[model samples]
Target chain A: MRLLEALALTITNGSKPVCRNQNFHLQAGEIWGVLGPNGIGKTSLLHTLAGLRKPLSGQITLMDKPLASYDRKQLATQLGIVFQDSQDTFPSTVLETVLMGRHPYLSEWAWESVEDISLCMTALEQVALATLAQRQVNTLSGGERRRLALAILLVQNPSICLLDEPTNHLDLHHQMVLLELIVQKTLRNNGGVVMVLQDVNLVPRFCTHVLLMHNADSWISGPVADVMTTTNLQLLYQHSIRKLVDNGVTLFYPE
Target chain B: MPVFSPAVPVLSGRYFLVLFFVALFAALSFVVALGLGSADISFNDIVAVLTGTSDSLNQQIILQIRLPRVQTGMCVGGMLAMAGCLMQILLRNPLAEPYVLGVSGGAAVFALLAIVSGLSGLWINGSAFAGALLSIFLVFVLSRIGNDWNPLRILLTGVVISAGWSAFISFLLAVSPPDQLHGMLFWLMGDLSYVQSSFWNPIVLAVVLLPSLVYARSMNLLATGDLNAAALGVNVTRLQYFIYFASSLLTATAVMQGGSIGFIGLVVPHLVRILFGSDHRILLPVSVMLGGSLLVIADGLARSLIAPEQLPVGVLTAMLGVPLFLVLLQTILFRQRT
Candidate 1:
């Protein structure tokens, strides 16, 4: 129902260009995985798409119009973005933090209405943080905080979500939880998720599409079955991969 | 399980402490100050003179001159401290204050130019306010260079503006008649003796700074950093610009009216923060009240410390305020470290 397109995108930070002649499109109803080495500009690309960053060249369009045309707050209503690092200044409770999603709709001084509080709690309920609503943001455990971050975005009610690293600071179980929640939100809204990931095997499981960036070069990207082969994984990472069948699931990891 | 009272709030509990001590100390200063001078008046007589309206000059001394000056000290002192607190919170820096941040220096330069250029009385206050505004405006512009908008720009610009103004004030001092030079220097260092009741206008004008800062209950969000604030949909650019203009307007108004009250802006906010923490709602009002009381005490000491010789009130404020300020700064840093 919705299409987000990056048209002939180029990103440069003064000297040499970082990304050049790149294009990607996301149609609603599936998650797209971005796989890349450390300097491959995965985060930068996500930032540009979210309108949090300005690109050196090229344009992005949603629903056939230029991306810049969407007012940032309005775009926020349709697209939620999760940043990589947590900040130090926010001292509001989890409930207050999540309710900030209603910022674009409320006047500068209006109190959060019952509807706003309900929406925020609903996001907390989705993330299994309903009990943590009164807890200070700084007091949350790393895994819990990441969950809260997602909850805040969920309250934003965006149709298309962009996550730089949904699992960056998470332990294994929390990582699984975050991935599950993202998948659930996308499926419920018939929305798309474009996520940056380094773990290659994760792409085949929850991600419907995968894009790999290696040594400053853009590589294979397509449906998981076509792009997530052992040879392609090895070429993109410059490492070997071993696939093992455990129970019924196919697991791929570097040997 | 610690249910923090939303009303009393942790911040108020802490800030009320600094507020109380400064208030009590100012009250003591008022009583002691009324008992001295070349024509020594008994403390009891001063109180009696204050309550009953006698047509005598001695009674007039208690009512019109002494009482208003003391009241003026209390009001102006509070206004300066309030201005300092607002500036610090607006900039989101603990080190930000009105006097040292070039708001006063800029205003002082303008007021000086107006005074020597044949402007006198009320005209001096307006010129000073305009000067302070211009200086702070310039500093704000310089700091926001390339739109990077760092605190360092404001700090550096303030220092440069102060140096330039200091040079200009010195040049004016060099050419003025010898009798007037002492008066000019006294004004530069900041004194509270010319305590006119009409100075209340600037105080009223500064009321806007209070709400501009208080409304940002979201300012606590800023402590998280600009990127985080932006991600939260904080109109970051707009907030930054608004704070800069508001703090400048407030600081300029105080500097124009109060010659140069010292240490209240810098030290009071620091003390309040150490006692209360960094919430603006608590910090702002506490700073205002404490600032008033502190100046009352300082002005009292300036008048009464010597039998007949009156000292500059700024001298006394720095004398009392600096040592306490150092102790607070040291205690805060040490506690924060380990």
Candidate 2:
């Protein structure tokens, strides 16, 4: 829709540009990976898209209308986001944390419906955390908390999923577990998954399209096969690239 | 092991919660409070007074003075405790008490202002409510200056403002006209002796504020902490403003009647949290009951222990409440750590 469209959407902190006037199309059913180095504008771009932060200039169109036209409540139901640092240090139980995702669906006086409870259970099951529903987030290990956070977003069931650094602090096992679940659910339902990821390796495995953010201003986005190259990876990181062919993953290290 | 049923688990609801033992206990305490003291009446006599069979001077005292005072105290204590609980939640700081964020002190200043200005006691409530709102507005404006508002910075600003107002109150007493000194001192010390049959407005506020907080559980979840709640799709800004207004109203209404009942707000919610866990479903209502009974019991001792000479109920609450809070915090922390 024209409303959700972003034409030259830019953000900056004083003189430095975070996301330089970028244009992108977000459609349902496609999982888009946001790849970048540290201090780049990937998180900023995600925040602007999520409406958590405002843009300096330009426009965002949704449903052939301006994104700002929809109120926070209206936008929330259609857009679910799982932010970076899913580290919930509170003693809230896994079930309680997951049930919070149902906030947009329920009213002030309404308790969780039978439908809400079952949806929460199914979301946990998708993240393979059905058994740990009663445990506290503070008691869980790093990887477990990451998966539980993913379970929260899944339960929300928004049309567009914006996840920032979802794979950070996760073990290889959970990294694959979360990415596979996102692809399976979004692809099947024809929903959109726009996530910021650190590991360039996982991008090829899960993402159909990738946006590479180098510095704050530059991005080269297209098919994963196009964006993940020795030259682009080296340039993005300002480093010498070493490729491992059999593993289907490339490593970048500073010279 | 036998398989647990796949059906939804049926936890206890309003049968045990709404209008049951909790309410029953509070009602019993209210009756017991009315019957206690020098003119101790039998339950039969108390019943007779209510039934209009007894018209003795003792019956008159029981009906006219003691009943309203005791009932009003219970309502006042409940409002103070719940207000404090919600304020702490809204601020998301464990150390938050009723006046810690300057809302109550701001109310106290306006309340004191109304009293010194020769306004009626009821007018004090309106002034106090407005003052609390204004202070919050000021603090909100101050904290947002030149950057995104930081909660810790706001907390510090509140402390400074509270101390400033408190000192101003002492200054009022020190330099005031001799005739007005006695009343100002009473208000500052927080006496429950002014209770009369006409004083039910605070109860209305308590009833309304209590149900509103209960009905809005999503607000409680957001007030627990901001970022976690926001990622789950809570409109945090709107919720913050609502809680700010609601919590301020609660504190202002409470201070109107309760006269700075210390520690009920701080200790009662902390007790509720420890007993049933941090979920506000159990916390808000339990704090109301426990706080009322605890204050009634404290006031009973305050009046009966030294008889004719009245000790301000605020001192009693602070002395009794603070130690118990320390012990409870230590125990909970020890358990969590181990």
Candidate 3:
């Protein structure tokens, strides 16, 4: 099933156009990575795809309907976005924060049922945060907070997931665990995942397809094997690259 | 079959227990406030009047004088605190309160106009409400100039509008006759003693609170930030409108009842958050209860502090709330540093 499709999309910041003439299609059972240099409209493209930003000149359809046609509630049940960071000004417990994901399913003034609570609990356990569910979110560290964000999205159970910098702050162990969890969950549900990442190695390892944004009005996107070549990556990053092929895996790094 | 272990869930039993105590405290404060006048009505006398066994002078004082006053206090206090909670959530700023958006200043300006023109009772209330609604509309329109409903823009607009309202208020005061100054000052300082009937206050309180309670869950999502709420499927724009309208009406009603009572709105929610968690489902109700109780006690003190003379209830709320607010700020600063 087609999860999201963009046609001739153009995004702008103020009067200046940031990206132009973009076309992409995301389908179920696919993991796509969006990569670019800093300030190259990567976040803007991610946000535009997630319906957080409107394209300057094109149409976006989600779940076979126009993105603008769906109301907030309808859109929320099908699509979820995990932000890079979240602020915790008010002191709500981790459990309470995670349970907020059930909001789209439940009616107003209805309490969380046993099923909702259990789902949130399972998501917390998946993120290794079940024990800290009683603690305040304000007391969490940067990595733990990111895990909690993932946990919230897990509990939300959206068909399509949009994540920006999903591994920005994490230890080596957690980075692998979170990426695997996201890929596993999306594949299980037959949904697509879109991620904005900076790491070069993670893209070749996990992403089924890759979109490399160079500057405004320019981009290259294709299957990971076709797009993530040593020459292409070196040109995209404007740097000298060293490539190594060990068995079936390929690694690209700047020399 | 060898062993059975019950899983201890994370759910705690303290919520209901704490709620019960808060209600009990409000009830206790209500009963205590009834007997705290210069006429010296005893606890037994209040009970006798309630049970229909007494018809003495003290009964008249309790029923005619103190009962309506206390009821108004509770309603006004609850309304202010509830409005404050909504404002804080809408702006995502801890220091945001009811009057931070100039609702009270607008009310005070129009209310002073009515008072100076010798308008009595409902006319004053009507004008104050109209003025408050005007301020709400002005702030809403001005803040949406070239962007979406940005909290910083809204807040900055409200603060500037508040400054404008204060200047208007000063001009009104400067031109008013000397004889009406006492009445104007009393009204501006917030006097619960002037509350005659308790019908509209309770009705407005219920109308605003019941609907707002239904949206408590959304408010919880909003406290995190706009993006989080939006991505989670909440209609952030619609929710912001609901909050602004509800909070403005609540503040207008409170100002109409008791002339812009301060600090109860600003302080009560923080106090409730400190005690209970920040879930609005719990914080909203507890804030209303505690706000009502605190105002009743403050009014009691205001009435009894100089027996035979009364002080504006706002004075006591500020005196009591300022110190508590200072302590809260200090604690917040202390936490940020570490």
Top TM-score prediction, candidate number: 3
Local distance difference test, candidate 2? 0.71
Residue-wise C-alpha lDDT for candidate 3, range A1-255, written one tens digit per residue = 899999898999777676788888999998999888777777778788878878888989997889999877778889989998889887777888899898899888677777888999899999999998876688889999999999999989898999999997888899999999989999999999999998988898889999988767778899998988877777778889888889977887788
Candidate 1 residues lying further than 4 Å off, grouped into runs, are A62-67, A70-72, A89-102, A113-148, A154-157, A214-220, A238-245, A248-252, B1-91, B99-101, B108-127, B144-147, B151-189, B199-207, B210-218, B266-338
True contacts kept of 1: 0.19
iRMSD, model 2, in Å: 4.5
Model 2 lDDT per residue over A52-94, tens place: 7789998887666677777765777777777777533224667
Residue ranges of candidate 2 with Cα displaced over 4 Å: A1-4, A86-91, A247-255, B1-19, B42-44, B110-134, B144-150, B170-186, B197-215, B323-338
Candidate with top lDDT is 3
Docking class of 1: incorrect
RMSD of 1: 5.7
Q: Is candidate 1 or candidate 3 better by TM-score?
A: 3
Native contacts recovered, in order, as a fraction for each?
0.19, 0.22, 0.67
* lDDT for each residue of candidate 3 in B32-68, tens digit (9 for 90 to 100): 8887766777899999998879976877889899999
Chain B TM-score of candidate number 3: 0.91
lDDT of 2 at B117: 86
**DockQ score for candidate 1:** 0.22
* Candidate 2 docking classification: acceptable
What shift in Å separates residue A92 of candidate 3 from its native position after superposition? 1.2
